[model samples]
Target: MSIAPNQCTVFVQVWVDVNALAQGSTRGCYAVSNRSQQSSGEGSANLHTNVITSSNVCWTVLPIDPQYTGDFSITNVGAESGWEQPPAPVAGMPNVFTGKLTQSTVGGSVNSNIQFSFDGDNQITVTLPVTITPVTQ
Candidate 1:
């Protein structure tokens, strides 16, 4: 049996309310990572040459095909964007944004601090655990 390093990871979060309109012990929550970016500023800039490195840059695990309609803040992120924070994520694995990917740690968890404001009595931020399975040829 050969299980080739087959499993790419991605992060997904959804948020929703859970009370007053009882739907069970759970509610729809959006996945959030503290590494989420703030887009109300500059685009990617090369500090070495002081030029804008424009490309599809995502700081954290954001839904590529976003289903919800709202605005998110992608904050001060630069060359060292995409990283989860101090005490890093071991070796070999870079904390940098790897394209359209949000890591779903097998033996750990990633915490994202997302801000939410709604016009309802129930409010909560949920970090959804998304699974990624790599396909083989």
Candidate 2:
């Protein structure tokens, strides 16, 4: 699917504890924030988007700690008719993801999760919950 040049982009900053993650401890190893700066709270943030028919939106995942190098995979937890199937990570740009608002009769929302896995000695996966709301316009 081709995305518009001016498509709205949502940025999700991933905070990770490299040491803890490497040690296979996911307790407080992962957190997601919409802001570029780190927050005291640990967990994912709700991301809202306003869209028109065929509107394209992109999600970019940025790991706070550059030391933690791993690919991110996004999964839709529930089906939302207002949005087309979410796109996979852009090839060569593993951190970038895209989704398009559908022309459904009704606007809907969906809960999605992104998993960041480390291919290091200890394979650990951290899932960040995200809420996607498509507002029909």
Candidate 3:
């Protein structure tokens, strides 16, 4: 698999379908002005459903409290990593390298940074960036 010079689109769909507490005929929907970690309200009631980060996307979301020492085993080799699949549909394939992403929450502010690089790139630095998304629930 090969990543071109530009292509890192991380689309996180928060809570656009959830209906919040109704005041009248107007049903509540996710508004662009809402920004809060505890926005997942209705999900806790129906379907016992909770937001689970879709790991299929390239990033992982860390909480806004405490801190984290990012660590995970690599799940693929460079050739068949992201979009490319291994020649054989074998299980337990590993990533080329491992990394640590650090995040800390202070004064109600969330700060996080995750870094990953392609060791093969000699001329330039290759990396995958992490994105945080807030949604209504």
Most lDDT-accurate candidate = 2
Scored against the true structure, residue 45 in model 3 reaches a CA lDDT of 15
CA RMSD (A), model 1:
16.4
**Which residue window of length 10 is worst by lDDT in model 2?**
33-42
The residue-level lDDT of candidate 3 at 120 comes to: 22
Could you tell which candidate, 1 or 3, scores higher by TM-score? 1
Q: Candidate 3, residues 1-137: lDDT per residue as tens digits?
A: 42211232221211211112212211222221122233323222111111222212222211122332222222332232222212121123222222111121221211111222222212112122222321123
**Error in Å for residue 98 of model 3:** 11
Candidate order by lDDT, decreasing, is: 2, 1, 3
- Kindly report which residue pairs in candidate 2 clash with one another: none
lDDT of 2 by residue, 1-137 (tens): 53432465434445556666677665544444343232234353433333344655565554556766565443322234556755445556555566665655444545444565655665566665654444444
Once model 3 is optimally superposed onto the true structure by TM-score, how far is the C-alpha of residue 14 displaced, in angstroms?
Answer: 18
Backbone clash count, each prediction separately: 16, 0, 5
Clashing pairs in 3: 1-79, 74-95, 75-95, 76-94, 76-95
lDDT of 1 by residue, 69-109 (tens): 33322222222232222111212322222222122233222
* Model 3 lDDT on a 0 to 1 scale: 0.22
Model 1 stretches with alpha carbons more than 4 Å out: 1-26, 29-70, 73-124
Each candidate structure's TM-score, on Cα atoms with residue i matched to residue i, is 0.22, 0.59, 0.20
